[model samples]
Target chain A: MADALLETRALTAGYGEMQVLRDISLAVQPAEIVAIVGSNGAGKTTLLRAISRLIPCGGEVTFDGKSVSHATADEVFGSGLVQVPEGRQLFDRMSVEENLRMGAYRRGDRRAIDDDLDRMYTLFPRLSDRRRQLAGSMSGGEQQMCAMARALMARPRLMMVDEMSLGLAPVIVDQLLETMTAIRKEGVTVLLVEQDVHAALSVADRGYVMETGEIVREGSARELESDPEVQRAYLGEV
Target chain B: MELLAQVLVGGVLLGGLYALMALGLALVWGVLNIVNLSHGALIMLGAYATYYLFTGTGLDPFAALPITAIVLFVIGWLIQRGILNLVIRGPMFNTLLITFGIEVILTYLAQLLFSADFRAINPPYAGNNFRVLGITIPLMQVLAFAIAIGLTVAMWLFLLHTRVGRGIRAASQNLVAARLYGVNPRSIYALTFGIGSALAGVAGGLYGTVSQINPYIGGPLTAKSFAIAIIGGLENPLGVIVGGLVLGIVESLTALYAGSTYRDVASFGVLILVLILRPTGLLGRTT
Candidate 1:
């Protein structure tokens, strides 16, 4: 088996006194696309947040062989684990290009950044056309594209995307899934949290089923797709 | 017509100084999201540093600028690291209160050390003036104005071209992503505040050559800096310069036509109107 790029061992976290994640353990292999599917408030987003060190967490979160559980959010990011948060979170007043440039803020590789930017522009040609436009003015789908591209600009070893399909139209969602598959093919590992079970499983190499903040089941995407329990509970069919 | 031209030139020159005065406040507000009430006190400290240097060692105020900036930078760094950092991650109101407390402490300390005597730095060429286009302008005012604009431009260039400047800007935009860049926010916060205070100090030193300094001057200077920052917007560095010039011209026209006492009233009234009508100053895009 390929080495895990990221590993979470019995991880637990929550806001204030409310425990949201209860001993959730997971791992992502290098260059693999892993998807976590769950109902709303099942601690999927919270899990990503904890792994990124945005919130205080417990147990072990190791990225690239470094302990990230006690690390600050910024430290976690410095270790090449980047998160495209639930909301687009683009700086609304900034131009689209400026927002993308901000993603490479920690990096000094100007040549590489420029190359990545050109690649992003090619991936989302609409963004290239509206490069100078304010991010807030863009349509929802356009903003999502910008957010994903911005995260890519970081040249992350592991990218965590939360609710990539949220509030997006079906067509846009399909396009985004295609982009995610393409990104995975580029040798970048991805950890995707999604409500769109069918769409997620279609592109995901492996799938984890989460319920009430715990990983209830894990298997190959094909296995989970045909599982009776997954069909009844998440696929909305018997 | 000559009087109008003279006032216009004077207003423009004064506006440059005003821009320098507001630059630090705008930087602190823009980057650190801290409205430093003690900003004027740092400016006051800069003036005192210049005054003492000139009186003791006879160094020219302009030449002594770097010294004042360094001293003020140290002071700002210590304040941020020791006092301000504790409450920085808390509510905005906490920051305001802590900075206000700092203002009071600095003011009382200045009063004890410097006294309330109004002081000015008079170099050998202090009384010199030159006529340009039939309008008389002081040599010191021209020099101060040039230095002010020069420093402001340099600051803009630094932020745009340098890695550290980008880090500061990134931190202002998103703290988490800024950290991903390997920027220790605690140090960045201190460095930004230090740079802001250093700018204030330079402004204060230049101001001493052009105006009077007392412990009481800090309050009004703070108010003027705040007005300039709001009028300029927090997003762009160049906006402060435009905001300063606008206020300077307005104050000059109001003082000439209305009265001297109406200067603050006019400047602050315009600030209020701008906030009400368009809160994001000229260069700032509404968020």
Candidate 2:
């Protein structure tokens, strides 16, 4: 728990009078792929938003031993807690290369930024071929890849990806999961919020099952996969 | 035929200045989503600032542009950060009311301080004219046109090349996403309004050299700026040039053919036509 890169204590958040997240507590260790899987409107996105400080939340969010609950979104991002938001929110009018450059907006080291750019192209080869293309013009799979690459350019210590598999083909989702594993192998912690319970747990080291704004179950990926309640509610397997 | 050629040339020159006038309004409207009804007031302030610098300090009006731009930039930054940002998230109507209020306050302030006397910046070379291809061109108008075009192009490049410029564009498209990439929306919004006001300042300085300036000129100038911005489209910065040119030429042609009294009729008529035909402006792509 002390070594956890990201930990939330009784986090609660909502929009206006409508509360979405209720006392949700979760932790992600360094270099680990942790998934928070749930159905639609289960507060997975709101939890991610709360952690990233995009929305106001109660309780505490600690990142890398520092309390960041009240930190502004810019501070959270600058502290290397980055998020690849849902819906592949790419700057539609800007070119693919520009989007990646924006990801490195906070970095001052020019040489390192360029090196990271090259690394991103190598990681997502399709992006290299379409560097000049507008981000919005790309296919959904390609856009998602670009979004992931854009976040990586920031050289974050921990990256939170929300709904990465949304509106994508199954094969594309598998490829993305492989990319997430590879990203974790490079010593970056990942908090993946996904609706696909089976796919998320397969690659995640540990998983939490969220239902209706609260975490109902939490365990190792293998344990969650074997749990009959989780299978019955999410995996469609009884 | 010679008269028509002369009028067209004059219109083109006027169009260049018009482009510069609308550039600031377009930038602010496009990025900040604040239509900035006070934009012309800022322009009026710029013109008065230049007028005073020329008369009081003996500085050339052209040389006074940067100073005016900086002054207006500060004022704009303060206005946005101090007033507009508070109600920015409330409703679009609040911004409209606040900006309009600013415009009225500025107009009254100018009237009390500078008086309603019409002033012009007349350098010794003001009356100098050059003849080319059987058409006479006033040196001051040409210089204003050249500076206008230069500033407009520079603004376009700044938006394309600089980090802050990219931040403005990114913030305009999506504030939440831009914040995720380490952009502070409040500061960026303030900086963008400042830049837009600076452009307006430069345009106002150029306007002083070419025409007469008065405190009441702000309203008409703001209306003209809106016309140009709409004709050019809000999406592209360079669209202001085309929009400016269209309005200038239309006005000149109307003055020459339908008499000077119908100039507004022609310009606004074209605006109505553009609105009916292409709601996105000339360069804006249909969504």
Query: TM-score per model for chain B alone?
Result: 0.98, 0.98
DockQ for all models, in order?
0.37, 0.60
Using TM-score as the measure, the top candidate is: 2
Q: After superposition, how far is residue B50 of candidate 1 from its true place, in Å?
A: 2.4
- Give the per-residue lDDT digits (tens) of candidate 1, residues A125-194: 9899999998889998999999899888888888888898889999999999899989988988999999
Model 2 regions lying over 4 Å from their true place? B285-287
TM agreement with the true structure for every prediction:
0.94, 0.98
Model 1 per-residue lDDT tens digits across residues B11-115: 999999999999999999988888999888899999999889889898988999999999999999999999999988889999999998888989999999999
lDDT of candidate 2 over A72-174, digit per residue (tens): 9999999999999999899888889889988988888889988999999999999999999989899999999999999999999999999999999999999
Q: Each prediction's interface RMSD?
A: 3.2, 2.5
In model 1, which residue pairs have backbone atoms overlapping below 3 Å? A106-B181
Task: For candidate 2, state the interface root-mean-square deviation in angstroms to 1 decimal.
Answer: 2.5
